[model samples]
Target: MTARVLVAGIGNVFLADDGFGVEVVRRLAGVELPAWAKVADYGVRGLHLAYDLAAADYELTVLVDATARGDEAGTVHVIELDTGRTEQTPCLDAHGMQPDVVLNLLAWLGEAPRRVVLVGCEPEVLDHRMGLSPSVERAVGTAAGAVVDLVTNHGR
Candidate 1:
């Protein structure tokens, strides 16, 4: 059967913790995922994300991104994007688009997933350099575990 839960990791790997999303997916690769969970490392490419939001068959989607939520470095936050409060909150990242944009666009296209959850991480450093910061690297496990929990519980 087609997957029921989609986990997308979005970020720019070259820019330190900007790659948090991708790194989380990488760490999750070693674990055994349910049959209905699908994951991908979608590096920075708005069009790519738009495509998946428009064309995927999953009923639920989990997106991981580097966010500035004023949390400590390596902090993992599980954000329910379906809530109304997120609509007015502006994201601190200038290069990235809000998760709402993806949901709204998919809704407009009549391809929206049944539910969407956003997993966010505060960046210790987003410098345009190679690799994740030490702190952010340490947070990968936490972020990956969060995704696993979300998918394993809701996936079926």
Candidate 2:
């Protein structure tokens, strides 16, 4: 059976700029989409996201987050992850959702999704502050749109 598509926003809303993914998904929640498109906010629980991916519930997964890619703040990026390059290694902590570990866990499950995309925003601040930084806030909608595009444009 063809798995569905998942758009998961991963980050902590309590931390400044880190909340970009949560905000993006909040915006997406109101938008109309196909039944196969599943959107969720997986804040701080990287392990949860990992197990979900391991379930192979999605043919394609779009993970939205604030990534420190050394780019300008608020920069939106759509990066396609080569899951084939993922290693089948398990992490010690299965309680946290470290993005890299989550992806790796999927490979360890031996049924990783066919495609994984990362829709990230460069964060201005990741300190212990609620809400997104001004720069990151501006990119939320753009990232949401990007996630939608990834799902709709996927060939499988």
Candidate 3:
């Protein structure tokens, strides 16, 4: 049987520019989508998301987050994590315990999704301030649309 597809957006809304993922999810709230697809605003609970991914009947998982890799503030990129490396490795706990660490651990624990895609946005700032930078906000629509297309095509 074909499994469901989960599209999750993770970030800390309180931090400036860090909330792009969650904002994208919010924009997707009213979009008409196939039944096998689920979209969520996960905030910052990476470990919980890993467990959720493990428990869900999903064959494909799409994760959205912000990356510090220097691109334009609103530039978006998609990456596929290596299943073997993610599953067999212990991730470093840098800058506090990261959610990717949990994702890698879940992969190790046999809860890995059959296919995973990470949609990352380059952020200009991640300060303890309010609102996304103008550039990041501008890319939300394009990113959200891309996510929808990915789910619609891959959810089968």
Give Cα-based local distance difference scores for all models.
0.77, 0.81, 0.78
Q: Write the per-residue lDDT of candidate 3 for residues 58-115, one digit (tens) a residue.
A: 7778887787787778998888865444534755443322446866777677765677
lDDT by residue for model 1 (3-105), tens? 7888889888888888899889888889899877888887775556756767766777889988889989888889887622223322333356456665655
Error of 1 at 104 (Å): 3.7
Stretch of 10 with least lDDT, candidate 1: 83-92
lDDT of 2 by residue, 68-107 (tens): 8899999999988877646447674743445677777767
Better of 2 and 3 by TM-score: 2
- Sort order, lDDT high to low: 2, 3, 1
What candidate 1 gets wrong by more than 4 Å, as runs, is 83-98
For candidate 1, the per-residue lDDT at 129 reads 92
TM-score of each candidate structure, all chains considered together:
0.83, 0.89, 0.86
lDDT for 136 in candidate 3 is 93
Steric clash count of candidate 2: 3
Best by lDDT: 2
